[model samples]
Structure formats: structure tokens, C-alpha cells
Target: MKKIDWYFDFISPFSYLQGELLHTLPAEVEIRYKPVLFAGLLNHWDNKGPAEIAPKRTWTFEHCAWLACKHGIPMTMPPHHPFNPLPLLRLAIALGSSPEVVQRLFRWVWREGRVPTDEIYWQALLKEFDATPEMLDAPGVKQQLRANGEAAIAAGVFGVPTAVVDNRCFWGLDSTDMLIAWLRDDPFFSSEQLRQAQQLPQGVHRKT
Candidate 1:
């Protein structure tokens, strides 16, 4: 399977947008949603953290609102971001199958703008999926999620919505389609060097 590592933050609208966009991929392309602390990655990258991530935050809400309407996916981001996604990341990791959680979280945060901190929001969000908070907060699962997060960082991801197709990192949901185009278009891999190049976060790695 050609694995696409999807690095995303629950708070990121682009990540949310990308989650929705992912539905367009052909089933042959296996996608692995690797939840990472984008905030932490920003802190590690530079001094201006929020200021940098803020635009991404803004971009996600605006574009995704339109995309949701276009794709028939409900989306709303106002008042406050749905929740501190770190916990949800942990939950996804714990679940060991974050596709459903990632999909659901994107809906609640992007489509509803409900913060994850709100117990009521969680209840409502999980209810839609026929799930309960207990599913996300299962025993021994949180610690495992943390480990998965650490593994993402170790893999050299510095931000959310980073997709790796053939180890070529594509950041943001906007780039997702392009990434798929490259993946599906056999001509893209014309050169062996291009195919074998290392693709990691910009500062730490190169996109040769």
C-alpha cells in the first residue's frame, strides 16, 4: 500500500479541511492519520508560534466553511475553536484507529466551531457517531496515543496536515490534491533521484 501519513492538529482548519478533502482519494491509496501537536511543533520551530499558526487557523475556517457547503459536510468555526486538540490526539492514539476520531473531530470543530473542552460539545459530537466519551477516554489508550505523537515528531514532522506520499511531505489540505495527483500520475516518478529523495519538515529536512 502507498501510505500517506496525514499529520494534523485538531485546532487547524487546514487540517480540518484536509480531512474532508481526503475523502476524495482513491481507496488504493492507504492514508494513515498521524496526529501531532502542531502547537508544540511551532514552538520547536520558532519564537513566533501563535502568530504563525494563526493564519492557518484562519485559513481553515474560511476555506473549509465553503468546502463544507460544497461537499455537503457541515462546518462552522466561530466563538471559539472546538477544543484543545491535544487531548483528542491522545484519544486518537489510544483508539489506535484514529480515522473515525479524526473524521468526527474535524466535523465537530470545523462544522460546529465547538471547543473540545466543552463536555457538552463532546457529548453532542460523539453522539452523532453513536460513540461516547468513554470510547475516546478508554483505559491504557491515552499513554499509547502519547507514544504515537512522539513517534510523529521523531519522524520529522513539524506541523499539522503534512502528508507524506512516497516520503514527500505535502503540507496543508490545499496541497493534498496535488499530492494525490502526483501519486496517481505515474509520470511524476520519472527520475529515480526524485523518487528516493528525503522529504521531511522544511527546516529539519529537504524536499529534493
Candidate 2:
């Protein structure tokens, strides 16, 4: 079976949306759910998240809400954007990071609009997992999370909701169709124009 590594974080609404659509991939494909800290990626790339910018943050949520409606996926923004996703990431790793656990965690945050800081709801989530906060804090779980982050960087992942297939990083929720097409062996992927596109030279770089 073809394997795709899905890199995501609970802090991203796009990640949650993409998780809902993973069912659309070909049946023969295997999805490996990877929960990585989005912030870690930003740090590695010396980049800023969409939510770090004021106006982009507004547009990002608005666009995601529109996309959710268009796709008929249930999505509600959490009480806050860009919250620490380490706890949730560790929890998923601690629970083995299965598709079920990852999807459930995404829904807990995006579908239900809840954060880990919400005592009552958070407690209920822990009960559902048969786990406690202490369990999530285990050193092994934390180390696994770190390893996932390292793996993501090695895979050239600069964003969440990325699907790494054959070492090609298809980043963003909007690239789902491209990913599906590529998986089905679309000829455009092998076209000369595509090859040339990859060789395009940078005209300029923005001053840091």
C-alpha cells in the first residue's frame, strides 16, 4: 500500500478541516497521522504563522469557515487561535497517534470549539481517552513529539496539513486535490512544464 505521512497540529483549523477530508484519498493508500507542533516548524523556518499577523489571522479564519461550509464539514473556531498545541500533541502521541485519536482530538478542538484550558470540557476529554494530564506529560511522549517535529523538518514540511508522499511535500489544505491527483498518477506531474517550474529561479528575496 502507498503510505502518506500527514503532518498536523491541533492549533490549526486547516489541519482539522484536512483531517475530515482524509477519507477521500484512495483506499489503497495508508495515512500515517503525525501530530507536530506548528510553532516548532515556524521556528525552524524562521517564519510566522498566519495567526501571528493581525489581518491575516482574520482572513485565515474567515476563509477556513467559508471552506468548511463549501465542503460541508463541521468546523468551529476554538476560543482562541494559535494556542499551545504541545499538550494535545503529546496526548495524541501518548495514545499512539492513531487516525481515530487524531481525528477525535481535531474535532474536540475545531468541531466543539474547545481548548485544553477549558477545565470541564478538558476533563471530559481526558476521561474519554482514559488518560490524565500527567499521562500526557510523560517524558517519552514529550520526546516522541520532539522527534515528530524533527522528522517534519527533515521532510521539508513548513506548514500544517501537509501530506508527504514519496518525499514530496504537498503543503496546505488547498492542495488536497493536487495530492489526490498525484496519487492517481496524473500525467501533469511528469510534464516538462512541471519540471521547468521546479527549476524556476528566484527573482528577488524580501529584506528580513
Candidate 3:
């Protein structure tokens, strides 16, 4: 089976949406979920999130709602836009509960509009998985998350909901279609195509 690396951060609603659509991938493909720090990547790229800017921030909220509706996924914006998702991410990683508990977390935050602050809520969330809060403070859990972030940066992933199949990266939730299409190709991109693509001048950086 072809292995695909799915890099994401829960802070991104797009990532949550993409999780819902993973079933669309070919059955022959195996997805490896990687939880990375979104903020870490943004800081490395010196980029600002959509919510950090004006007009775009407003558009982002509207767009998130529209996208969720379009995808037919239940969504209600979390009370906090950019709250710390480290605990959530770490818990998922420590438990090795990808696409299940992770999916639940997405729904819990976006669909249920809950921040999960109370210990009772968290215990309830992880009850089925048999995960304990002690796992959050477990040694190397934080380091592992950091390593995932650095590895993502090394792999040219600057955003969440990125799918990497055989070292080719497809970014953003909307790119899932294209990523699946790439997987079906008998022959991937030609060597000449890559050469021509890389030789082209870099794109103009837009001011935020």
C-alpha cells in the first residue's frame, strides 16, 4: 500500500475538515497522521495566520463556516479562535489515536464549541481510548510534537492539512482532490517538468 503522510494541527479548522474527507482516498493508501505545531511553522516562515490580520480575519470566519457547510460536516466555531492545542495534540499522539480520537477532538472543539478546560471533560474525552492525563506530562511527549514540527518544516510543509505521498506535498484541505489524482498517475511528474518548475523565479511575496 502507498503510504501518505498527513501533517496537521488541530488549531486549523481546515485540518479538521480534511480529517472528515480522508475516506475519499484510495483504499490502497495508508495514511500516517502527524501532529505538528502550527505556530512553530508560522514563526519559521515569518508568516501571520489569517486571524491575525484585518478583513482577512473576518473573511476567515465566514469562509470557515462556508467551507464546513459545503463539506457537509458539522461545525460550530470554538469559543477561542487560536487557543493552545498542545494538550490535545499530545494526548492524541501519546495514545496513538489518529483519525478517531483526533476526529472527536475536532468535533468537540468545532462542532460542540467546547474548549475542554475541565478535567472532567478531558477525562470523559479520553475515557474510551483508555488514555490518562498522566500521558500529557509524560517525558518526550512535548519533544515529539516539536520534532514533528521541525520535520514538517524540513519537508516544506508550512501549513496544516498537508498530504505527502512519496515526498510530493499537497497542501491545504482543498488540495485533497489533486493529491488523490497524483496518486493515480502511472508516471509522476517528468524530470524536465521539475527542472523547469524549480528554475522559475520565486513568486513575489505579498505584504500582510
- The candidate scoring highest on lDDT is 2
Return the lDDT, model 3, position 91. 84
- Which sections of candidate 2 miss by over 4 Å? none
**lDDT, residue 6, model 1:** 79
Clashing pairs in 1: 7-161, 13-60, 75-111, 76-110, 76-111, 82-114, 82-115, 82-116, 83-115, 83-116
Q: Candidates 1 and 2: which is better by TM-score?
A: 2
Q: Where is model 1 more than 4 Å wrong at Cα?
A: 47-60, 63-73, 123-140, 186-208
lDDT of 3 by residue, 60-132 (tens): 8889899989888888887777788888889878977467777887788788786657556667887866877
TM-score of 3: 0.88
lDDT by residue (tens digit), candidate 2, 130-181: 9988899898998888998999999999999899999899999999999999
Candidate-wise lDDT, in order = 0.69, 0.92, 0.83
Task: Please report the TM-score between candidate 1 and the true structure.
Answer: 0.72
